[model samples]
Target: MSCDGDQHTMQSSDDVLPPPGDIQVLLLTLDSVSLSWSSPQGLIGPQTFRVTWGCDGETSSTRVKDVHHLKISSLKPGEKYQFNVATEGEDGRQSRWVSASLSTVLPAPDQLTVDSVDTTSAAVSWNQSPGLDHTQHHYQISYRCSGTEPHITTTSSPSITLCDLKPATEYSVTVCTVLENGKQSQLVLTTFTTVLPAPDQLTVDSVDTTSAAVSWSQPPGLNQTQHHYHYQISYQCPGTKPHITTTSSHSISLSDLQCGTQYSVTVCTVLENGKQSQLVSTTLTTGSCPEGWRRFGCSCYYLSTEEKSWEESRQDCLERGADLVIINSEEEQTFINGFEPDSYAWIGLTDSVTEGTWKWVDGTPLTTPRYWWSGEPGGGTYQNCGEIYYISSGQGVWRDYDCTFSQQWICEK
Candidate 1:
């Protein structure tokens, strides 16, 4: 074919068909462009083709020789362009711009990216090369029902997120680049969705008078996999102070609690993404010792009779399946003194049946004696027996009363 004057003429059977060349315009991307064309029959065996393209009507041209494809980089986004191909044949050059006009695809969604995902919300962000000038562009960010969006568009913001989504649902999404020029490109798909909140099932293993053991399970939903949790517990026991502890494990031990008290316990789950679950609460009972056995020094002790001789007190305590009070330290003497009665009661100390040597019924030596009332145990001629009697003053003291005197003898185990 030839371009003579206004149009070209074709020979009978030979030049009837337009030159057989395949032309294609590929939008390499927003920053680059590629125009490709091939002639299965390029003149003869090893004939080469020259490809050229530019914005239609522009004087500048880019040329690629020999190869059938031409990749042009640094092209403006959203710009319309055209391409054409010519062959170097044995009959000199053949043909003019024979193919139709073509345009580059709008640049892939600019600044495409995900910002954040939460239990009930997701934050997405992106930036676009708004043509030659920087301006807010329109974008349609479509998301899958579960994960991140696969694509993005131009007219849309560099980012946008779908709201009010079900927790833990898988989603696919894409941003459609809507140009200010009103061109809508193919969808850019990305998959994402809102994450599930922490688990809600929490409970106490058991409650004691002063403390409770608590436990809870992870939330049930998507994204629970491959994630660990932290637990925070808060509780209150009657007549005691509130308490709290943090742990990765589901259980905790609480100690030093008051007896016969009602307690309230709450537990909350912490998601891997730093989200906290609702607090779960329950009521429990703290373990307590029996009545009248007030805990002192981690043990229970009581002076049996308000008034009894050392021997009498020992027998009384023995009848109750206990022993006459064993005084361990000065602190204990001070403690027992606080419960003093008007009359003297027998303690475990004694020098009866012999003289000048004190011994406990259990036969333990007194390592330390506390508060012996002034001028104690003056065992006169026959005062070998132990007697607890008040002195002239209000203070009480022990005296060696005769064992045969019949004064109330105290007994312990």
Candidate 2:
């Protein structure tokens, strides 16, 4: 009976299977792991392997046959786990368990947001990932403009400020958590557009009686060709409505402006989304005549306040860089006549060079339609210079006079 019992015990021992060997982690990710092992040497008959994994007081197990690898998924990130593998024979006999331990990669930072944005920079922040050693981990940040190459950087803090970004342009940013072991989490992406930049170097290139030409340069470090925004120009005089216009070009001409007026001009950049930049401003004054001068048909006329001889009056006009008024049309004669009614003034007309032959100061011969009095120039050789005098009928006419006569005169530019 003892010999029979010993044989049975030896048979039972031979039937028992040995555990798998060299269990190793083949792959590890934030949420899964793949494991592989070598089968026990030469003792398995229709046997299956039992894989068990546990984390944070929770355990799960599964069985596999004829396979040297097992993949465990749906696992929590940044958590340490314990795994065990054992061999099971067809007769329900099992071997000792092989144990291994590993930790998953850290999770991605959560709630990524853009705290503030400006023309050339932006501030970004995120919440720290749970269950991580803050001092042992860092974040990798990448950013780029639309359709452009990306820039990469790293930060140990949960927030970072990105600088030198383009204005009014779309940009994408990616943030990822990196552990001291060189493991990284999945990338988290976000996008934002910078505010438009204000135009600079505002200039009023030229100003005329009724119009102005203005130009400006785009802001520095901005790519004008890539941006489609326009410039808004507003010009206004005190107590008047503003004149506003938009243009894609760097220069514009404002027409129908008031002459001799000072205008406040302002320019700003406007994005397609209707966002506007700060305004750049300048001031310009339109063409105007000098004080104490009267404007008429693009010319300025000054009437002398005192009287003098014809030669002396001509000298006075010469000192002022002007010449005696030469009436060229009926309207001009009428304007002068009505300016100082019934007053005698020395005109530029003269016949002193040749009696019976009249000419103007510019050496032009007097033509018909002249404002000569009915019987003017009757003085013949006695009267040499000409003057304008009003008749009792209230009509202004020209008369020959002596060169030594004293009277007021008109100066024209």
Candidate 3:
């Protein structure tokens, strides 16, 4: 062909530059990559290299002269990229392209948060790393209470709930992203404290006309040495305001309560930080009368079994925080009559202060509807105190009796 002519001729394929060989990724990071390659086999003179990369349908390229390494920056984190390198000759001829595929290191998760904390559990969540597919990645969570070993768990979701945590405890939590290839990102850390635990097994130990005794099991892990916390008890009756008290003891006696009422009692743990736990509640009904006393209407009555003089009986009633029974209404009179139909009992009515002027124990003058036996005041000054007498016919009537007469009596409060 004609080497005789002086005109320049087209070069053969043998003269064309070969592609770069052995493309290697030297380093990969969250948002960049460093790459290097062996220059085409000898026979090259002042060659330039063209490097191209693409990800998510976007492509970019750069040219470097006399260099075997290329550094790519501003790449998206946690993304896969395809790269190619070729050699360029002085005459503008390019070699075939050499290719490689690589994935950038995943980035740490962001905005770590803990919420919805209770005595035994909490919910944690975070924003996943950008450019990573949620379905192709998972999250690893590690948590621990103060002075305890760590616990680890995994979830495909960005959010997870942790259970069986200790109450009123400070916890450290770390979250990280995991790739399908088992690669993990740096751990992001946060801390939160669980709410205090509530008292359990609340019960009314004892109840009476005007007071109640209540007890509960202390919250788990609580000890008397930890004096920073205490139990708060609150009680309320229908149509009344709530009453509150705090005690270090597990049992408390509540007083000044109304008789014959239903009370709702709630107990909770209060921390030094002013945090209160969930409320544990119970209900109880108070008895209308104290032990050995009978309730009638709004009053409590006690009938003495031993016989005594009128003055001695009044002294006993006063010592018992009561006074001799006063028959104020026909209903009361009938009730007293039915109590002991065949026995005589001293009543509150008496004329001892002034003869013939009957007065009740409360110093109120006795009025109409009086039940008097026929010719009852016949004893005159000798019998100045009043008493209830039952005839053989079982009819109860008021009769004058001596102050020293020995008879059973009734007390009212």
Top candidate (TM-score): 3
Candidate 3 local distance difference test against the native: 0.81
Worst 10 residues of 3 by lDDT: 1-10
- Cα deviation at 271, candidate 1, in Å, is 7.8
For candidate 1, the 10 contiguous residues with the lowest summed lDDT are 1-10
Expressed as tens digits, the lDDT of each residue in 1-413 for candidate 2 is: 01110111111223267888978999998678999999887864665887778776667777788998988887766668888877877775767778899988778999999999988999999998765643378999999986889999999999999999888778999999887766788899999988877888998887655678899998655665776688899999999999899999899999877777899999999877788888999999876555766766645577888888888888888787567778888877777776673368887888888887888888898896588888877676768888877554434889888878788887765
TM-score preference between candidates 2 and 3, better one:
3
Off by over 4 Å in 1: 1-97, 129-137, 147-156, 161-173, 180-183, 186-253, 256-330, 339-413
Give per-residue CA lDDT, model 1, range 1-413, as digits (tens).
Answer: 11112222221223322353777666456545566676555355564544444563442343344567767665545666555555544454445554545555565555556678776567666656445255334776655552444333333336555566656555666666666676766666555656655546566665434545666665555343545667777778666667887887756777666555677877777656666666778777665323443335543455543545445556666775566666666665555544453445556666764577766668876556644656766666555544445444333455555544443333321
| Over 4 Å off, model 3 | 1-48, 52-88, 91-103, 110-116, 125-138, 147-149, 152-161, 178-183, 225-228, 238-240, 260-262, 283-287, 290-293, 297-299, 302-338, 341-413
- List, residue by residue over 122-212, the lDDT tens digit for candidate 3: 9998987766753378889999986788999999777899999877888999999887777788899999888787897998888766778
lDDT of candidate 3 at residue 378, scale 0 to 100: 56
* lDDT (C-alpha, whole model) for all candidates: 0.56, 0.80, 0.81
Q: State candidate 2's TM-score.
A: 0.50
The collision pairs in model 3 are none
